[model samples]
Target: MNERAPATSPEVLAAGYARCAQVTREHGTTYYWGARLLPEQSRRHVHAVYTLARLADDIVDLAGPDPGPATAAALDAFEASFWDAVDTGTSPDPVMAAVATTVRECGIDDECFTRFFGAMRTDLTRRTYDTWGDLLGYMDGSAAVIGEMMLPVLRPGTDAVAPARALGLAFQLTNFLRDVGEDLDRGRVYLPQEDLRRFGADPHARVVTPEWRALMAFEIERNRRLYREADDGIPALPGASRRCVATARVLYARILERIEAADYDVFASRARVPTVRKAALAARMVTSREPMRLVHRDRAALDPLGGTWVSDDPVVLLDDTGSPVGQAPKSAIHHDDTPLHLAFSCYVLDPAGRLLVTTRAASKPSFPGVVTNTVCGHPRPGEDLAEAVRRRARSELGVEVHDLRLVLPGFRYRAEMNGLVEHELCPVFVGWADGDAVAPDPAEVDDVQWVPWEEFRDDVLAGRRTVSPWATEQVPLLAGLGPDPRAWPAGARDALPPAAALGPAAEAA
Candidate 1:
């Protein structure tokens, strides 16, 4: 007999649900209303798609200032990895995994996902469409694919592709008209150029002119026609699915009505459908069931699986504590030469109360991964020596120790590693780790281990350990603290070092 567990873990499923629910509440009020009409299983899947899509949108839209290059690269990587996960049925990225589950469960067309990326890519560079055809092409990739993807989930084998595509385009175009001014402020223009030209309007010019009004009226009617065409396919959808689509259509359509009511003055201010109106639309959709015929149109050119786009390198998922199975420390040295002035040190302590010290990684740019004292750092501006040690210890070794009394402050050391000059004022602290396990965040410490204090001092003195300049300078001072210096290792023993052991110049240097 063979044993098996569930295909997806409960934790993963819960995470997916929470992510989707949060994103839906943030971005998809109307769509969320439609989602309620779905069966529980299908509803979960819809939310998953919404979560993934919203994340993708944020990568381009909300990432920091000057995000164009970074956003573009990230999107390309995400899209490539997304398709790879779909093809292979596994993904390291959580968002992609959720989307893959939705894809597999819903039997959605893969092209819809590709088109979504295509729309996102368009947002990266294109601000205006040259013609109605151009605008439709953008919508096909941006919005139509969403409907196509959902259709499979709503009705497994329905042939309503034509109607879904039309509806998606109609909804998207309406959104463009409504958000024209807002988009323009962000340096984007979604209105079709040919229509602008036809109405003697310049999209780049100010809003609310005679020409703009004419163009708005023309575009609104065009969307209304597309909406009518899309309605024809609604009855063809499964009963539950039709109502959901109807609610979305009616809700979006009101935006166009709002534009008209505003006297086609989208340039002065964008149009929006109020919540009360949206409620009315939802109610009307629930009571109405009209079957309209959809007219099929010539299809646009499909996007090719374009260039060989590279996805991001796989992320190694770790537990909440940031540990991976069988992981080992990666050694490297830190030297400060760059504008950021970055440097770091690691303290290795074992369960036997010994500290293991090693040279930094040879590949590092700073100290070339130099061997260093138990703790090290660059004294940040406005940070005293004691404060710096606390921050570095906690951040590098995940050991939060307080009562950091500085044994020696103002001890300056200099060394050159990998063409970078390292100048540091060594401030040594004796602190105690209160039974806290060391959890090294990889971006800093590479390896750590505890070794006997006597052994560590001998290794440094004998040159067996390639100690950093600061560490080399501090070892003798640390050793002189007691008969068995290991017994007083920094944070452990409470008694302070005798004040007479060092001159004021050495102590305060």
Candidate 2:
């Protein structure tokens, strides 16, 4: 719902909105890219919301390490002044004028602002968070409230309070993870102290030790869970609003990817999505209805296949520790927010060490017709992943034999193809075919080739042969294992995902 413009003059509101847009662009490019997909009216409201939050943050932070008496007083005054504008429905301050207009037009709840300011005030006194819960208490105001504030502007078809708040928390957590080093320098550490002790990680050292990596990996998993929770609210949003949120969510989550690529090193430099990519994503969201034509879930376009709490071919659900919590059917598991599950990928090689490349059947539902590794399939609940690899190899490609060893035991990725996601903790295995003969399954692999493993790896690295997203990442790491796949060092059974229980078939490894 929208209301008539506040009595604020058109020239004044436009200038205020223009300033707000600049602030969003300068400080929050991901947000700007997402809002670019919104209609002009909603976009303006987003700018106003961001403007108020950003300026308030500036009031709290611009004083740097020495936020003396004036800083708290200034923050309180800014908060009071914003409310005054909201109360009068007008303001002499240009940005405040636009922001107040948005508050009136969008019917944003005043309580959100109450929590938000309260959190900002807490920041002035509180420096370290003792546990995840403690940090969440502060984020409830500093971050999650931002989502509630945006709900009125988003105008979801259904009430999306929980997911929106989760999305806000996810975004802020991502920020905390990416800015850990910066925060530490500022006499604050957003990471939970309990988690630090549990992992035996000392962020104060600012080194990428194994313990630090473990801690970061755990935190990243928790962050992704929030993103998954937020995905439920996406379908409830319509048109450009949905596009806006989806683009922003995708872009923001990518920062975690960058952090990983940098070996979870936040101290060296800020990990970020290049501005060019953000613009390209924004353009794609604006131009194409499906964006990537990979993960389409537009409610008006297609009704999703209904899922149940229970599953027939169950996928072992995992907690943040990568341990199974329960199960959901393979058929019912995947959607926009596919849960991370246990899966295995097998890269088959012929006697000559030539890699077996397979093209997925064109008629398949997800990632149809994509060329990828020899076999990729999920482990049945309680089934061994090594056995799953062998089963998929025989069933999908009709070839497999010796050297069944895990190569990338920690291989995990999130990818979308043909409207479904393959979010899995997929351990990769390398095996050699016993014989040269092959029979590709018409239902799974319609075509197959035996490319020299070196040539395939080089082509993948050089962008000559575009395969699956997993393949794109796997090639480089596999190359580092050895020049020849036949001689690569074998991975031990202890490295498999916690849910992938070892069975007799896996004992062969």
Return the top candidate by lDDT. 2
Clashing pairs in 2: none
Please give the lDDT score for candidate 1: 0.60
What does candidate 1's lDDT look like per residue over 142-178, in tens digits?
7788778877777834578888888888878887888
Q: What are the clash counts of all predictions, listed in order?
A: 28, 0
The TM-scores, one per candidate, come to: 0.52, 0.60
Report the C-alpha lDDT of model 2 over 1-509, residue by residue, as the tens digit: 22434678899989999999999999988999999999999999998999899999878766775577799999988998898888887789999999998888889988899999999888677778898789999999999999999999999999999999999999999999999888776677889898899789999999999999988877886777677678878888887998899888888988988999999999999999999998887787787765424123322113233222122467788775578888987754675457788877888888787888999887665577899988888788778777777777777777766667677887888997534678888888888887678898887777999899889998999999999999888889899998977777766667767777755454223
lDDT of 1 at 425: 31
Evaluated against the true structure, the overall lDDT of model 2 is 0.82
Worst 10 residues of 1 by lDDT: 298-307
